[model samples]
Target: MHGRIRTWGPGALVLLPTVLLLGYFVYGLIAWTFNTSLTDKHNARPVPTNHVGFENYVNLFGEERFLNSLKNLGVLTVAFIVGTLIFGLIWALLLEKGVPGEGIFRSVFLFPMAVSMIASGVVWGWLLNPSQGDDARGLNRLFSILHLNFLENPWWTGGSRWTTMASIALPAVWQLSGYIMALFLAGFRGIPPELREAARVDGASEFKLYRYVLFPQLSPIALSALIILGHMSLKLFDLIYAITGPNQFRTEVPSVYMWNTLLRSDMAKAAAIAIVLLAVVAVLVIPYVAYTVRQENEE
Candidate 1:
Protein backbone atom coordinates (compact mmCIF):
# COMPACT_ATOMS: atom_id res chain seq x y z
CA MET A 1 0.00 0.00 0.00
CA HIS A 2 2.87 2.35 0.84
CA GLY A 3 4.59 1.58 -2.46
CA ARG A 4 1.32 2.19 -4.42
CA ILE A 5 0.82 5.47 -2.56
CA ARG A 6 4.38 6.54 -3.36
CA THR A 7 3.79 5.85 -7.05
CA TRP A 8 0.42 7.68 -7.28
CA GLY A 9 1.00 10.33 -4.58
CA PRO A 10 2.42 13.01 -6.89
CA GLY A 11 -0.57 12.95 -9.28
CA ALA A 12 -3.02 12.83 -6.38
CA LEU A 13 -1.35 15.79 -4.69
CA VAL A 14 -1.55 17.81 -7.94
CA LEU A 15 -5.30 17.21 -8.21
CA LEU A 16 -6.05 17.88 -4.54
CA PRO A 17 -6.11 21.70 -4.75
CA THR A 18 -8.27 21.67 -7.91
CA VAL A 19 -10.75 19.32 -6.25
CA LEU A 20 -10.76 21.43 -3.10
CA LEU A 21 -11.24 24.64 -5.11
CA LEU A 22 -14.15 23.17 -7.03
CA GLY A 23 -15.76 21.97 -3.82
CA TYR A 24 -15.28 25.36 -2.17
CA PHE A 25 -16.43 27.40 -5.14
CA VAL A 26 -19.16 25.23 -6.64
CA TYR A 27 -20.33 22.58 -4.17
CA GLY A 28 -20.22 24.92 -1.18
CA LEU A 29 -22.56 27.44 -2.84
CA ILE A 30 -24.95 24.68 -3.85
CA ALA A 31 -25.05 23.45 -0.25
CA TRP A 32 -25.64 26.98 1.02
CA THR A 33 -28.49 27.51 -1.46
CA PHE A 34 -30.02 24.16 -0.54
CA ASN A 35 -30.02 25.19 3.11
CA THR A 36 -31.46 28.59 2.25
CA SER A 37 -34.32 27.04 0.32
CA LEU A 38 -35.43 25.20 3.47
CA THR A 39 -35.71 28.48 5.37
CA ASP A 40 -38.40 31.18 5.19
CA LYS A 41 -35.94 34.04 5.21
CA HIS A 42 -36.61 37.13 3.13
CA ASN A 43 -33.29 38.66 2.11
CA ALA A 44 -34.75 42.01 1.16
CA ARG A 45 -36.40 42.48 4.54
CA PRO A 46 -34.84 43.22 7.95
CA VAL A 47 -35.27 40.09 10.06
CA PRO A 48 -34.29 36.63 8.70
CA THR A 49 -37.00 34.06 9.43
CA ASN A 50 -36.57 30.49 10.62
CA HIS A 51 -37.00 27.18 8.83
CA VAL A 52 -40.33 26.80 6.98
CA GLY A 53 -40.09 23.30 5.56
CA PHE A 54 -41.65 23.07 2.04
CA GLU A 55 -44.11 25.94 2.28
CA ASN A 56 -42.14 27.94 -0.25
CA TYR A 57 -42.27 25.08 -2.70
CA VAL A 58 -46.03 24.73 -2.17
CA ASN A 59 -46.47 28.42 -2.77
CA LEU A 60 -44.35 28.22 -5.93
CA PHE A 61 -46.56 25.47 -7.32
CA GLY A 62 -49.73 27.34 -6.36
CA GLU A 63 -48.76 30.40 -8.41
CA GLU A 64 -50.16 30.49 -11.95
CA ARG A 65 -47.20 32.52 -13.25
CA PHE A 66 -44.76 29.95 -11.90
CA LEU A 67 -46.65 27.13 -13.61
CA ASN A 68 -46.79 29.08 -16.85
CA SER A 69 -43.06 29.71 -16.67
CA LEU A 70 -42.43 25.97 -16.30
CA LYS A 71 -44.64 25.25 -19.30
CA ASN A 72 -42.80 27.88 -21.32
CA LEU A 73 -39.48 26.38 -20.29
CA GLY A 74 -40.63 22.95 -21.41
CA VAL A 75 -41.74 24.26 -24.78
CA LEU A 76 -38.50 26.23 -25.29
CA THR A 77 -36.38 23.26 -24.26
CA VAL A 78 -37.99 20.91 -26.77
CA ALA A 79 -38.02 23.42 -29.61
CA PHE A 80 -34.45 24.66 -29.06
CA ILE A 81 -32.99 21.16 -28.65
CA VAL A 82 -34.68 19.78 -31.78
CA GLY A 83 -34.04 22.83 -33.92
CA THR A 84 -30.39 23.24 -32.93
CA LEU A 85 -29.53 19.56 -33.29
CA ILE A 86 -31.17 19.07 -36.70
CA PHE A 87 -29.87 22.34 -38.11
CA GLY A 88 -26.39 21.83 -36.64
CA LEU A 89 -26.15 18.27 -37.94
CA ILE A 90 -27.19 19.35 -41.42
CA TRP A 91 -24.68 22.22 -41.41
CA ALA A 92 -21.90 19.91 -40.20
CA LEU A 93 -22.72 17.31 -42.85
CA LEU A 94 -22.66 19.92 -45.59
CA LEU A 95 -19.33 21.32 -44.38
CA GLU A 96 -17.89 17.80 -44.20
CA LYS A 97 -18.90 17.20 -47.82
CA GLY A 98 -16.85 20.24 -48.95
CA VAL A 99 -19.81 22.22 -50.22
CA PRO A 100 -19.31 25.41 -52.24
CA GLY A 101 -17.76 28.26 -50.28
CA GLU A 102 -17.61 26.01 -47.23
CA GLY A 103 -15.33 28.40 -45.38
CA ILE A 104 -17.66 31.35 -45.93
CA PHE A 105 -20.67 29.30 -44.95
CA ARG A 106 -18.96 28.14 -41.78
CA SER A 107 -18.02 31.71 -40.87
CA VAL A 108 -21.54 32.99 -41.47
CA PHE A 109 -23.08 30.24 -39.38
CA LEU A 110 -20.58 30.66 -36.53
CA PHE A 111 -20.58 34.47 -36.47
CA PRO A 112 -23.78 34.60 -34.44
CA MET A 113 -22.11 32.61 -31.66
CA ALA A 114 -19.28 35.13 -31.42
CA VAL A 115 -21.69 37.93 -30.56
CA SER A 116 -22.89 38.42 -26.96
CA MET A 117 -26.28 36.89 -26.15
CA ILE A 118 -27.72 40.35 -25.46
CA ALA A 119 -26.53 41.60 -28.84
CA SER A 120 -27.93 38.56 -30.58
CA GLY A 121 -31.25 39.10 -28.83
CA VAL A 122 -31.34 42.75 -29.83
CA VAL A 123 -30.56 41.94 -33.45
CA TRP A 124 -33.15 39.19 -33.62
CA GLY A 125 -35.78 41.39 -31.95
CA TRP A 126 -35.29 44.03 -34.61
CA LEU A 127 -35.44 41.45 -37.36
CA LEU A 128 -38.69 39.99 -36.01
CA ASN A 129 -40.51 43.27 -35.32
CA PRO A 130 -44.00 43.16 -36.84
CA SER A 131 -44.76 46.86 -37.42
CA GLN A 132 -46.21 47.64 -40.87
CA GLY A 133 -46.63 50.52 -43.41
CA ASP A 134 -43.79 52.64 -44.91
CA ASP A 135 -42.03 52.51 -41.54
CA ALA A 136 -42.29 48.68 -41.56
CA ARG A 137 -39.02 46.87 -40.89
CA GLY A 138 -37.86 43.28 -40.43
CA LEU A 139 -40.31 40.41 -41.09
CA ASN A 140 -43.15 42.90 -41.48
CA ARG A 141 -41.61 44.54 -44.54
CA LEU A 142 -40.71 41.24 -46.17
CA PHE A 143 -44.23 39.88 -45.58
CA SER A 144 -45.78 43.10 -46.98
CA ILE A 145 -43.63 42.81 -50.13
CA LEU A 146 -44.89 39.26 -50.63
CA HIS A 147 -48.51 40.40 -49.92
CA LEU A 148 -48.51 38.19 -46.84
CA ASN A 149 -49.44 41.05 -44.50
CA PHE A 150 -51.40 38.72 -42.24
CA LEU A 151 -48.09 37.39 -40.92
CA GLU A 152 -47.17 40.87 -39.69
CA ASN A 153 -48.80 40.85 -36.28
CA PRO A 154 -46.71 42.30 -33.40
CA TRP A 155 -44.54 39.38 -32.30
CA TRP A 156 -44.28 40.60 -28.72
CA THR A 157 -47.99 41.34 -28.35
CA GLY A 158 -49.59 39.73 -25.29
CA GLY A 159 -52.36 38.12 -27.38
CA SER A 160 -49.89 36.02 -29.40
CA ARG A 161 -48.02 34.18 -26.66
CA TRP A 162 -47.15 31.18 -28.81
CA THR A 163 -45.75 33.38 -31.57
CA THR A 164 -43.64 35.26 -29.02
CA MET A 165 -42.34 32.00 -27.58
CA ALA A 166 -41.41 30.77 -31.05
CA SER A 167 -39.74 34.07 -31.92
CA ILE A 168 -37.48 33.85 -28.85
CA ALA A 169 -36.69 30.21 -29.62
CA LEU A 170 -35.70 30.99 -33.19
CA PRO A 171 -33.02 33.45 -32.07
CA ALA A 172 -31.73 30.94 -29.51
CA VAL A 173 -31.41 28.29 -32.21
CA TRP A 174 -29.72 30.70 -34.60
CA GLN A 175 -27.09 31.63 -32.00
CA LEU A 176 -26.49 28.12 -30.62
CA SER A 177 -26.78 25.92 -33.71
CA GLY A 178 -23.39 27.07 -34.95
CA TYR A 179 -21.65 25.84 -31.81
CA ILE A 180 -23.50 22.53 -32.15
CA MET A 181 -22.42 22.32 -35.78
CA ALA A 182 -18.78 22.75 -34.73
CA LEU A 183 -19.12 19.85 -32.31
CA PHE A 184 -20.70 17.63 -34.99
CA LEU A 185 -18.10 18.63 -37.54
CA ALA A 186 -15.34 17.67 -35.12
CA GLY A 187 -16.95 14.26 -34.64
CA PHE A 188 -17.44 13.79 -38.37
CA ARG A 189 -13.87 14.76 -39.18
CA GLY A 190 -12.50 12.27 -36.64
CA ILE A 191 -13.97 9.33 -38.58
CA PRO A 192 -11.33 7.26 -40.37
CA PRO A 193 -11.23 7.64 -44.15
CA GLU A 194 -10.68 3.88 -44.45
CA LEU A 195 -14.19 3.20 -43.07
CA ARG A 196 -15.81 5.42 -45.71
CA GLU A 197 -13.65 3.85 -48.43
CA ALA A 198 -14.61 0.34 -47.29
CA ALA A 199 -18.29 1.27 -47.24
CA ARG A 200 -17.99 2.74 -50.73
CA VAL A 201 -16.17 -0.40 -51.92
CA ASP A 202 -19.12 -2.44 -50.67
CA GLY A 203 -21.42 -0.29 -52.85
CA ALA A 204 -23.12 1.42 -49.88
CA SER A 205 -25.32 4.32 -50.92
CA GLU A 206 -24.65 7.74 -49.26
CA PHE A 207 -27.88 7.68 -47.27
CA LYS A 208 -27.38 4.05 -46.17
CA LEU A 209 -23.76 4.74 -45.22
CA TYR A 210 -24.76 7.68 -43.06
CA ARG A 211 -27.73 5.90 -41.54
CA TYR A 212 -25.97 2.62 -40.76
CA VAL A 213 -22.28 3.37 -40.46
CA LEU A 214 -21.81 7.00 -39.49
CA PHE A 215 -24.66 7.54 -37.04
CA PRO A 216 -23.77 4.62 -34.77
CA GLN A 217 -20.27 5.99 -34.33
CA LEU A 218 -21.66 9.46 -33.63
CA SER A 219 -23.60 8.37 -30.53
CA PRO A 220 -21.00 9.57 -28.05
CA ILE A 221 -20.84 12.94 -29.78
CA ALA A 222 -24.62 13.10 -29.89
CA LEU A 223 -24.78 12.35 -26.17
CA SER A 224 -22.23 15.05 -25.47
CA ALA A 225 -24.22 17.49 -27.56
CA LEU A 226 -27.42 16.55 -25.75
CA ILE A 227 -25.83 17.12 -22.37
CA ILE A 228 -24.59 20.57 -23.39
CA LEU A 229 -27.81 21.55 -25.15
CA GLY A 230 -29.90 20.26 -22.26
CA HIS A 231 -27.94 22.30 -19.73
CA MET A 232 -28.18 25.44 -21.90
CA SER A 233 -31.91 24.97 -22.35
CA LEU A 234 -32.38 24.35 -18.65
CA LYS A 235 -30.50 27.49 -17.57
CA LEU A 236 -31.61 29.69 -20.45
CA PHE A 237 -31.83 33.37 -19.39
CA ASP A 238 -29.93 36.08 -21.25
CA LEU A 239 -31.54 35.86 -24.68
CA ILE A 240 -35.06 35.45 -23.33
CA TYR A 241 -34.56 38.24 -20.80
CA ALA A 242 -33.11 40.57 -23.40
CA ILE A 243 -35.52 39.90 -26.26
CA THR A 244 -38.62 39.93 -24.08
CA GLY A 245 -38.82 42.37 -21.21
CA PRO A 246 -38.89 41.10 -17.62
CA ASN A 247 -42.67 41.50 -17.25
CA GLN A 248 -43.52 39.75 -20.50
CA PHE A 249 -45.64 36.74 -19.55
CA ARG A 250 -45.43 35.16 -22.99
CA THR A 251 -41.65 34.65 -22.92
CA GLU A 252 -41.18 33.82 -19.26
CA VAL A 253 -38.67 31.01 -18.47
CA PRO A 254 -37.52 29.56 -15.16
CA SER A 255 -34.47 31.75 -14.90
CA VAL A 256 -36.41 34.90 -15.73
CA TYR A 257 -39.15 33.84 -13.35
CA MET A 258 -36.60 33.29 -10.62
CA TRP A 259 -35.25 36.78 -11.25
CA ASN A 260 -38.73 38.22 -11.06
CA THR A 261 -39.38 36.43 -7.79
CA LEU A 262 -36.17 37.72 -6.33
CA LEU A 263 -37.04 41.25 -7.44
CA ARG A 264 -40.45 40.91 -5.87
CA SER A 265 -38.86 40.07 -2.48
CA ASP A 266 -39.87 36.42 -2.64
CA MET A 267 -36.45 34.97 -1.88
CA ALA A 268 -37.73 31.76 -0.38
CA LYS A 269 -40.02 31.11 -3.32
CA ALA A 270 -37.24 31.99 -5.74
CA ALA A 271 -34.92 29.59 -3.97
CA ALA A 272 -37.60 26.90 -4.15
CA ILE A 273 -38.01 27.44 -7.89
CA ALA A 274 -34.23 27.34 -8.34
CA ILE A 275 -34.03 24.08 -6.39
CA VAL A 276 -36.77 22.65 -8.57
CA LEU A 277 -34.88 23.69 -11.68
CA LEU A 278 -31.71 22.09 -10.33
CA ALA A 279 -33.63 18.89 -9.64
CA VAL A 280 -34.98 18.83 -13.17
CA VAL A 281 -31.47 19.05 -14.61
CA ALA A 282 -30.24 16.40 -12.20
CA VAL A 283 -33.10 14.05 -13.12
CA LEU A 284 -32.22 14.38 -16.78
CA VAL A 285 -28.41 14.16 -16.42
CA ILE A 286 -27.90 11.70 -13.55
CA PRO A 287 -29.21 8.71 -15.48
CA TYR A 288 -27.02 9.43 -18.47
CA VAL A 289 -24.01 9.88 -16.21
CA ALA A 290 -24.71 6.60 -14.43
CA TYR A 291 -25.11 4.78 -17.75
CA THR A 292 -21.81 6.17 -19.00
CA VAL A 293 -20.06 5.10 -15.81
CA ARG A 294 -21.48 1.59 -16.12
CA GLN A 295 -20.33 1.36 -19.74
CA GLU A 296 -16.88 2.57 -18.77
CA ASN A 297 -16.64 -0.07 -16.04
CA GLU A 298 -17.80 -2.77 -18.44
CA GLU A 299 -15.23 -1.71 -21.00
Candidate 2:
Protein backbone atom coordinates (compact mmCIF):
# COMPACT_ATOMS: atom_id res chain seq x y z
CA MET A 1 0.00 0.00 0.00
CA HIS A 2 2.79 2.41 0.93
CA GLY A 3 4.77 1.55 -2.25
CA ARG A 4 1.65 2.06 -4.43
CA ILE A 5 1.00 5.44 -2.87
CA ARG A 6 4.60 6.53 -3.39
CA THR A 7 4.55 5.42 -7.05
CA TRP A 8 1.47 7.56 -7.95
CA GLY A 9 2.39 10.47 -5.68
CA PRO A 10 4.92 11.80 -8.20
CA GLY A 11 2.29 11.84 -10.95
CA ALA A 12 -0.19 13.49 -8.59
CA LEU A 13 2.39 16.16 -7.76
CA VAL A 14 2.95 16.77 -11.48
CA LEU A 15 -0.80 17.29 -12.09
CA LEU A 16 -1.38 19.34 -8.93
CA PRO A 17 -0.37 22.68 -10.47
CA THR A 18 -2.93 22.42 -13.27
CA VAL A 19 -5.61 21.27 -10.85
CA LEU A 20 -4.88 24.15 -8.48
CA LEU A 21 -4.79 26.68 -11.33
CA LEU A 22 -8.19 25.52 -12.64
CA GLY A 23 -9.75 25.47 -9.21
CA TYR A 24 -8.40 28.92 -8.36
CA PHE A 25 -8.36 30.91 -11.61
CA VAL A 26 -11.44 29.38 -13.21
CA TYR A 27 -13.80 28.42 -10.41
CA GLY A 28 -12.44 30.99 -7.95
CA LEU A 29 -13.05 33.78 -10.45
CA ILE A 30 -16.59 32.56 -10.99
CA ALA A 31 -17.14 32.54 -7.23
CA TRP A 32 -15.75 36.07 -6.97
CA THR A 33 -17.98 37.25 -9.79
CA PHE A 34 -21.03 35.77 -8.07
CA ASN A 35 -19.97 37.46 -4.84
CA THR A 36 -19.53 40.72 -6.65
CA SER A 37 -23.01 40.41 -8.16
CA LEU A 38 -24.47 40.22 -4.67
CA THR A 39 -22.86 43.55 -3.78
CA ASP A 40 -22.90 47.10 -5.14
CA LYS A 41 -19.45 47.27 -6.65
CA HIS A 42 -18.58 50.35 -8.65
CA ASN A 43 -15.37 51.17 -10.44
CA ALA A 44 -15.93 54.78 -9.49
CA ARG A 45 -15.72 53.81 -5.84
CA PRO A 46 -12.64 52.70 -3.95
CA VAL A 47 -11.12 49.20 -4.03
CA PRO A 48 -13.75 47.81 -1.64
CA THR A 49 -17.50 48.18 -2.20
CA ASN A 50 -20.53 47.79 0.04
CA HIS A 51 -22.97 44.88 -0.12
CA VAL A 52 -26.23 45.60 -1.94
CA GLY A 53 -27.68 42.07 -1.98
CA PHE A 54 -29.21 41.50 -5.43
CA GLU A 55 -30.11 45.15 -6.07
CA ASN A 56 -27.95 44.98 -9.14
CA TYR A 57 -29.90 41.97 -10.39
CA VAL A 58 -33.22 43.74 -9.87
CA ASN A 59 -31.88 46.81 -11.63
CA LEU A 60 -30.54 44.72 -14.51
CA PHE A 61 -33.92 43.11 -15.06
CA GLY A 62 -35.51 46.54 -14.96
CA GLU A 63 -33.31 47.95 -17.70
CA GLU A 64 -34.89 48.23 -21.19
CA ARG A 65 -31.60 47.65 -23.02
CA PHE A 66 -30.82 44.51 -21.03
CA LEU A 67 -34.31 43.19 -21.70
CA ASN A 68 -33.91 43.91 -25.40
CA SER A 69 -30.56 42.15 -25.38
CA LEU A 70 -32.23 39.07 -23.94
CA LYS A 71 -34.89 39.23 -26.63
CA ASN A 72 -32.26 39.59 -29.37
CA LEU A 73 -30.32 36.65 -27.90
CA GLY A 74 -33.40 34.44 -28.12
CA VAL A 75 -34.07 35.52 -31.69
CA LEU A 76 -30.47 34.99 -32.83
CA THR A 77 -30.09 31.67 -31.03
CA VAL A 78 -33.21 30.09 -32.49
CA ALA A 79 -32.69 31.37 -36.01
CA PHE A 80 -29.02 30.40 -36.07
CA ILE A 81 -29.59 26.92 -34.63
CA VAL A 82 -32.54 25.93 -36.81
CA GLY A 83 -31.09 27.41 -39.99
CA THR A 84 -27.66 25.87 -39.42
CA LEU A 85 -29.06 22.47 -38.50
CA ILE A 86 -31.42 22.23 -41.44
CA PHE A 87 -28.91 23.53 -43.96
CA GLY A 88 -26.18 21.27 -42.63
CA LEU A 89 -28.43 18.22 -42.62
CA ILE A 90 -29.49 18.87 -46.22
CA TRP A 91 -25.91 19.38 -47.41
CA ALA A 92 -24.70 16.30 -45.53
CA LEU A 93 -27.50 14.20 -46.99
CA LEU A 94 -26.67 15.42 -50.49
CA LEU A 95 -23.01 14.61 -49.99
CA GLU A 96 -23.86 11.18 -48.59
CA LYS A 97 -26.11 10.52 -51.57
CA GLY A 98 -23.00 10.65 -53.74
CA VAL A 99 -22.34 14.07 -55.22
CA PRO A 100 -20.26 14.33 -58.42
CA GLY A 101 -17.19 15.51 -56.54
CA GLU A 102 -17.80 14.48 -52.93
CA GLY A 103 -14.34 15.32 -51.53
CA ILE A 104 -14.28 18.73 -53.20
CA PHE A 105 -17.75 19.54 -51.96
CA ARG A 106 -16.90 18.42 -48.41
CA SER A 107 -13.83 20.63 -48.35
CA VAL A 108 -15.76 23.59 -49.71
CA PHE A 109 -18.56 23.20 -47.15
CA LEU A 110 -16.13 22.75 -44.25
CA PHE A 111 -14.01 25.72 -45.27
CA PRO A 112 -16.24 28.20 -43.46
CA MET A 113 -15.68 26.30 -40.20
CA ALA A 114 -12.02 27.27 -40.39
CA VAL A 115 -12.79 31.01 -40.42
CA SER A 116 -13.17 32.89 -37.13
CA MET A 117 -16.57 34.35 -36.28
CA ILE A 118 -14.94 37.82 -36.11
CA ALA A 119 -13.64 37.52 -39.65
CA SER A 120 -16.94 36.07 -40.91
CA GLY A 121 -18.86 38.89 -39.24
CA VAL A 122 -16.54 41.52 -40.73
CA VAL A 123 -16.93 40.09 -44.24
CA TRP A 124 -20.66 39.53 -43.82
CA GLY A 125 -21.05 43.02 -42.35
CA TRP A 126 -19.67 44.39 -45.58
CA LEU A 127 -21.96 42.07 -47.52
CA LEU A 128 -25.04 42.89 -45.42
CA ASN A 129 -24.68 46.68 -45.22
CA PRO A 130 -28.18 48.17 -45.35
CA SER A 131 -27.19 51.29 -47.32
CA GLN A 132 -28.87 51.85 -50.70
CA GLY A 133 -28.31 53.44 -54.13
CA ASP A 134 -24.67 54.45 -54.86
CA ASP A 135 -23.44 52.95 -51.56
CA ALA A 136 -25.22 49.54 -52.00
CA ARG A 137 -22.75 46.75 -51.04
CA GLY A 138 -22.21 43.16 -49.86
CA LEU A 139 -24.84 40.69 -51.15
CA ASN A 140 -26.78 43.67 -52.50
CA ARG A 141 -24.08 44.03 -55.13
CA LEU A 142 -24.58 40.40 -56.12
CA PHE A 143 -28.34 40.97 -56.26
CA SER A 144 -27.79 43.88 -58.66
CA ILE A 145 -25.47 41.84 -60.93
CA LEU A 146 -27.92 38.92 -61.03
CA HIS A 147 -30.93 41.24 -61.39
CA LEU A 148 -32.39 39.74 -58.20
CA ASN A 149 -33.33 43.00 -56.54
CA PHE A 150 -36.39 41.35 -55.03
CA LEU A 151 -34.14 39.13 -52.92
CA GLU A 152 -32.24 42.08 -51.53
CA ASN A 153 -33.37 43.49 -48.21
CA PRO A 154 -31.79 45.45 -45.36
CA TRP A 155 -29.88 42.58 -43.74
CA TRP A 156 -28.50 43.77 -40.40
CA THR A 157 -29.56 47.40 -40.28
CA GLY A 158 -33.13 47.39 -41.65
CA GLY A 159 -36.35 45.50 -40.77
CA SER A 160 -38.22 44.94 -37.48
CA ARG A 161 -36.28 44.15 -34.28
CA TRP A 162 -36.76 40.39 -34.45
CA THR A 163 -36.05 40.39 -38.18
CA THR A 164 -32.88 42.37 -37.59
CA MET A 165 -31.67 39.88 -34.98
CA ALA A 166 -32.48 37.02 -37.36
CA SER A 167 -30.48 38.82 -40.05
CA ILE A 168 -27.48 38.98 -37.73
CA ALA A 169 -27.84 35.23 -37.31
CA LEU A 170 -27.47 34.66 -41.07
CA PRO A 171 -23.68 35.12 -41.06
CA ALA A 172 -23.41 32.95 -37.97
CA VAL A 173 -25.53 30.27 -39.61
CA TRP A 174 -23.40 30.36 -42.75
CA GLN A 175 -20.22 30.03 -40.71
CA LEU A 176 -21.45 27.21 -38.47
CA SER A 177 -23.53 25.20 -40.92
CA GLY A 178 -20.38 23.63 -42.30
CA TYR A 179 -19.39 22.43 -38.83
CA ILE A 180 -22.85 20.95 -38.30
CA MET A 181 -22.57 19.37 -41.76
CA ALA A 182 -19.33 17.72 -40.73
CA LEU A 183 -21.04 16.39 -37.60
CA PHE A 184 -23.98 15.00 -39.60
CA LEU A 185 -21.70 13.56 -42.25
CA ALA A 186 -19.68 11.77 -39.60
CA GLY A 187 -22.89 10.50 -37.99
CA PHE A 188 -24.14 9.20 -41.34
CA ARG A 189 -20.84 7.49 -42.14
CA GLY A 190 -20.68 5.90 -38.68
CA ILE A 191 -24.02 4.19 -39.38
CA PRO A 192 -23.54 0.68 -40.69
CA PRO A 193 -24.18 -0.14 -44.37
CA GLU A 194 -25.37 -3.57 -43.18
CA LEU A 195 -28.09 -1.96 -41.08
CA ARG A 196 -29.18 0.12 -44.07
CA GLU A 197 -29.20 -3.01 -46.28
CA ALA A 198 -31.28 -4.91 -43.74
CA ALA A 199 -33.84 -2.11 -43.75
CA ARG A 200 -33.88 -2.14 -47.55
CA VAL A 201 -34.45 -5.91 -47.57
CA ASP A 202 -37.31 -5.44 -45.08
CA GLY A 203 -39.08 -3.46 -47.85
CA ALA A 204 -38.48 0.01 -46.38
CA SER A 205 -38.28 2.73 -49.01
CA GLU A 206 -35.39 5.22 -48.88
CA PHE A 207 -37.51 7.91 -47.27
CA LYS A 208 -39.10 5.54 -44.78
CA LEU A 209 -35.75 3.95 -43.90
CA TYR A 210 -34.25 7.32 -43.04
CA ARG A 211 -37.43 8.66 -41.49
CA TYR A 212 -37.70 5.80 -39.03
CA VAL A 213 -34.35 4.09 -38.55
CA LEU A 214 -31.54 6.39 -39.63
CA PHE A 215 -33.09 9.50 -38.13
CA PRO A 216 -33.46 7.86 -34.74
CA GLN A 217 -29.86 6.68 -34.91
CA LEU A 218 -28.71 10.22 -35.58
CA SER A 219 -30.41 11.65 -32.49
CA PRO A 220 -27.14 11.70 -30.56
CA ILE A 221 -25.46 13.61 -33.35
CA ALA A 222 -28.32 16.06 -33.55
CA LEU A 223 -28.25 16.58 -29.80
CA SER A 224 -24.49 17.19 -29.93
CA ALA A 225 -24.95 19.81 -32.64
CA LEU A 226 -27.73 21.46 -30.66
CA ILE A 227 -25.61 21.62 -27.52
CA ILE A 228 -22.62 23.07 -29.35
CA LEU A 229 -24.56 25.59 -31.44
CA GLY A 230 -26.71 26.58 -28.50
CA HIS A 231 -23.64 27.33 -26.42
CA MET A 232 -22.07 29.35 -29.23
CA SER A 233 -25.20 31.40 -29.89
CA LEU A 234 -26.13 32.07 -26.28
CA LYS A 235 -22.77 33.53 -25.25
CA LEU A 236 -22.09 35.23 -28.57
CA PHE A 237 -20.49 38.70 -28.35
CA ASP A 238 -17.42 39.18 -30.52
CA LEU A 239 -19.01 38.66 -33.91
CA ILE A 240 -22.05 40.84 -33.31
CA TYR A 241 -20.05 43.61 -31.65
CA ALA A 242 -17.38 43.56 -34.35
CA ILE A 243 -19.96 43.78 -37.11
CA THR A 244 -22.43 46.17 -35.54
CA GLY A 245 -20.09 48.20 -33.29
CA PRO A 246 -22.40 48.60 -30.31
CA ASN A 247 -25.49 49.47 -32.34
CA GLN A 248 -27.97 50.03 -29.51
CA PHE A 249 -30.91 50.14 -31.94
CA ARG A 250 -30.31 46.49 -32.85
CA THR A 251 -27.88 43.57 -32.43
CA GLU A 252 -27.12 43.66 -28.72
CA VAL A 253 -26.65 40.60 -26.50
CA PRO A 254 -26.01 40.01 -22.80
CA SER A 255 -22.24 39.61 -23.05
CA VAL A 256 -21.89 42.84 -24.99
CA TYR A 257 -24.26 44.49 -22.55
CA MET A 258 -22.10 43.30 -19.70
CA TRP A 259 -18.99 44.60 -21.45
CA ASN A 260 -20.47 48.06 -21.92
CA THR A 261 -21.81 48.11 -18.38
CA LEU A 262 -18.45 47.11 -16.93
CA LEU A 263 -16.72 49.69 -19.08
CA ARG A 264 -18.97 52.36 -17.59
CA SER A 265 -17.99 51.32 -14.01
CA ASP A 266 -21.16 49.38 -13.29
CA MET A 267 -19.30 46.37 -11.94
CA ALA A 268 -22.21 45.09 -9.86
CA LYS A 269 -24.60 45.16 -12.80
CA ALA A 270 -22.01 43.56 -15.06
CA ALA A 271 -21.37 40.83 -12.55
CA ALA A 272 -25.09 40.21 -12.18
CA ILE A 273 -25.37 39.90 -15.94
CA ALA A 274 -22.34 37.64 -15.99
CA ILE A 275 -23.86 35.42 -13.31
CA VAL A 276 -27.11 35.20 -15.25
CA LEU A 277 -25.18 34.30 -18.37
CA LEU A 278 -23.28 31.64 -16.43
CA ALA A 279 -26.55 30.20 -15.16
CA VAL A 280 -27.83 29.92 -18.72
CA VAL A 281 -24.60 28.25 -19.86
CA ALA A 282 -24.68 25.90 -16.88
CA VAL A 283 -28.25 24.90 -17.70
CA LEU A 284 -27.17 23.92 -21.21
CA VAL A 285 -23.76 22.44 -20.35
CA ILE A 286 -24.37 20.58 -17.07
CA PRO A 287 -26.87 18.15 -18.54
CA TYR A 288 -24.77 17.40 -21.59
CA VAL A 289 -21.60 16.93 -19.58
CA ALA A 290 -23.35 14.68 -17.06
CA TYR A 291 -24.90 12.62 -19.87
CA THR A 292 -21.56 12.26 -21.63
CA VAL A 293 -19.82 11.31 -18.38
CA ARG A 294 -22.54 8.75 -17.56
CA GLN A 295 -22.30 7.25 -21.03
CA GLU A 296 -18.55 6.98 -20.76
CA ASN A 297 -18.79 5.38 -17.32
CA GLU A 298 -21.37 2.91 -18.53
CA GLU A 299 -19.29 2.06 -21.58
Report the number of the highest-lDDT candidate: 2
Clashes of each: 0, 1
Best by TM-score: 2
Model 1, span 1-299: residue lDDT tens: 99999999999999999999999888887887777888887677778579988888888889899898898888788888988999999999989998989889988999988889888887777887767777789988988899997777676554555666767788889988999998899898999989999999999999999998888889899998898888888898988877877888878888898898889887777888889999999988998899899999999
Alpha-carbon TM-score of each model against the true structure? 0.90, 0.94
Weakest lDDT window of 10 consecutive positions for candidate 1 = 155-164
lDDT of 2 by residue, 1-299 (tens): 99998999999999999999999999999999999898877777777778988888888789898899988888998999999999999999999898898999999988988898888878877888786555678788788778887777888777887779888888888888988999999999999999999999999999999999898999999999999999999999878987898656588899998899888998888999999999988899999999999999999
Superposed model 2: Cα runs more than 4 Å off: 3-11, 133-135
TM-score of 2: 0.94
lDDT of 1 at 125: 75
